[model samples]
Target: MSESEAGRITIDTSRPHPARVYDWWLGGKDNYPVDEELARKILAADGTAVRGARANRRFMHRAVRTAAEAGIRQFLDIGTGIPTEPNLHQVAQGAAPESRVVYADNDPIVLRHAEALLKGSAEGSTDYVHADVRDPDTILRLAGESLDFGRPVALSLVALTHYLGDEDDVYGLIERYVARLAPGSHLILSQVTQDLSPEGVARAAELFRRSGTPFYPRTLTEFARFFDGLELLGPGVIPVYGWRPDPEDVAAQAEGVVPVYAGVARKP
Candidate 1:
């Protein structure tokens, strides 16, 4: 759909955005040339970006399913990328039809695809907020309308925190939400890291910077800091492929480093 299709958001075809580039990597047709160009550059720099994206996607899927099985009925997913099939709400609501989910993203392309994202299960609820993660207050306010903060809510920040540079108060922003969550609340995340492939990771970051979308690749410890004080789930913070993977999937990811670290933790 074109930007004009959604009068609420402005489309900037001039520059590449994280969501659009991510969409392009997933082989979606909703991205513009700018996004494709940057995605190609990142791919050239590190042939594993596409693989990393797929690994991250699988991590999100697994996390949502596990959360639903763990009795999490509400989800607040920030930096929710494009409306990929079997999206977060779809996976969660599939497991628990009464699930309620709220998606927030700063990208205009995501806003344009928000309508599709709302097609959740009949017994479930879905809402979208065009807000940035930097403004945790705005996300909390909007998401609260759809999710009950008094109860446990799974906050999914998959493949997103890396975009929040060191200059951004990402830790503080995350802590703000963690503090507000109830005891059973969970933090689900997967981020790009330089632990395995330092050279490839640096090259990908530089490519993103050249494309005007600077991405920071953190170390494993740095990623773990985001979940400080929380109880880590089994398998802990490891490569997305290292998470409790299906036997067949584990064989698929045994080749090389995925360049992504992930984990699901519960707020005490």
Candidate 2:
């Protein structure tokens, strides 16, 4: 595949970005000072912030593995933050060597790091798209080049959408993307929830706004609303950390919900 127009990407280091801040939270070196400052503030309120990022990554790993095992070989992962080791393609391709995966993100840092995320097994294909989640058409057009729309594809919007807030027509965006896929296509989503700690969530939301990134946490019910017309998977909508977890780590996640819930559903 041709290289994306990385020159078109603009990095505004004056303010913290969601991708870089999240990268810092995950303990990656791609983040900047502004990102670290905001991440530290969030961690001050929630000591498990780093653990939460790890859990979210683990959930992505499990979801991709489940999709690959279920024979879903094509993936369209939007809002794919900075490249981390064993990315979605790595997990899916490990389970199904021929899996075709497309990763998309708006951040220039993520685009610069796309080369690392593109590494895949010899039998699989991995590509990157520089686009925003708000523009569904661009993502669809770009992702379509790498994935087959006539077959089952997994659309992963992990740890995203929350950034869009309620006024962003989040559900409509999901429908726009999911409408292009064939039946049995999967919708894998993970979002922050404020049901357990509304006050802490509100504080975090304020921090994001002050950092120049508009983010709002959703309730469990609001988070589940995104799956209205789809068939939720077996485990159903649950905290990302607890969804089909191994017996050993389940209890540890129980102590702290991490204010995030995730689920996978299938289009009829």
Task: Give the per-residue lDDT of model 2 (tens digit) for 147-196.
Answer: 88999999999989789876778888888888898998999999887876
Error of 1 at 190 (Å): 0.8
Across 20-108, the per-residue lDDT of candidate 1 in tens digits comes to: 89999999999999899999988998988888888888888899888888899999999999988889998999899999999999888
TM-score of each: 0.96, 0.95
Clashes of 2: 0
**Span of 10 residues, lowest total lDDT, candidate 1:** 1-10
For each candidate in the order shown, give its overall lDDT on alpha carbons: 0.89, 0.86
lDDT of 1: 0.89
**Which ranges in model 2 have alpha carbons more than 4 Å from their true place?**
1-4
> How many residue pairs clash in all the candidates, one count each?
0, 0
lDDT of 1 at 212: 81
